[model samples]
Target: MGPAPTVHAESVDFVMLYIVAISVVLLIGITVTMIYFVFKYNRKKGHEPVDIHGNVLLEVVWIVIPTLLVLSMFYFGYTSFRELRDKPDNPFIVKVTARMWQFTFEYANGKKTDTLYVPLNAPVDLEMKSVDVNHCLYIPAFRIKEDIIYGQTNHLYFNAKQTGDYDIACAEYCGLNHSAMYTKVKVLLDNDFTKWYGGNWQPVKNGSASN
Candidate 1:
């Protein structure tokens, strides 16, 4: 309804809105056309059913237009996915471990917490995995989700442009207590985050500030 909450969220929103808009336009157009034809060709008016040959132009137009629309949607979606896979040179990495009904966020400094704490406007990369069964980490505000499977790792990253708390839920339906599998992302200011994260982590040689 409003602007994107994170840097990559806008890209996802763009692709989503494009598909939705196209679907709505086509839906209305087809519905209107179908109704008009139904009433115009009513049998009650004694309209003769003519065996007419199909028009090549009309058939080609329908086929080509739908094909182009599908290709365009795939293009937008693929580009957005590519952007998500590109990691920064000096990203702040967080290990996200999911189990039966809980999530744990481990920072570089070995500090673990249930609630994710990230600095505002800073890029955060998540390395996610599950201990037992499969799970999925979903953050609607950030428009990011990744599967957490045992013996495999998944990744998702986002830059929090806004400062506040956002809900994080498990989209995958696990065993009992799945409804309670939720957490919050607390976007803190730099000073506050530094205090929570302790001192400086491993230094970076990229001429930029380190987490």
Candidate 2:
């Protein structure tokens, strides 16, 4: 088994922290407002609930605040996505094929295998396609995931900074054995990867074997 997923970049970590901060701020604001309104307008405080139909200022405040919040979120999310999707100048390319219950990775030298082998600190571009049904290539550690349609190819790029093993799961339900369809990703040092790629490496018989 591989180690647990880890966020490998400062930028990704910052984006996650920003999202959490926004959520906390929104939650606290809503909670405080709810409590204040409830206690201030309670019946036991000699206060009768006045049905002041609606205030134009209050309506505008609510609408404008939410609109601004949503737009801000959209802008940040779009920029982050674009940054992640942008291709590097010379990224390592790998072809990933998904079938009924297994994943096969093919490197640039035409070596096919079950496990994904990548060099640490090197950006990898994965071209994914499904042979039988729809599947999703998900690598939580890298915060990258994309769907692999039967007739279409999907792509994603990421650089792995840590040299270790990670899990590759099929996010989409393809068949009865979809739950069992999974693989491993091995991130190696640059020297070790060069040695492996330079030497003749045979493909494993099935996706269950280790790299």
**For candidate 2, lDDT tens digit of each residue in 134-209?**
9999887767788999999899787776888888899998989998888989998767987989853332223323
TM-score list, all predictions? 0.93, 0.83
* Top lDDT prediction, candidate number: 1
Question: What's the lDDT for candidate 2?
Answer: 0.79
Query: lDDT values of the candidates?
Result: 0.87, 0.79
Q: Pairing residues by index, what is the TM-score of model 2?
A: 0.83
Worst 10 residues of 2 by lDDT: 201-210
| Candidate 1 lDDT, 56-88, residue by residue in tens | 999999999999999999999999988777767
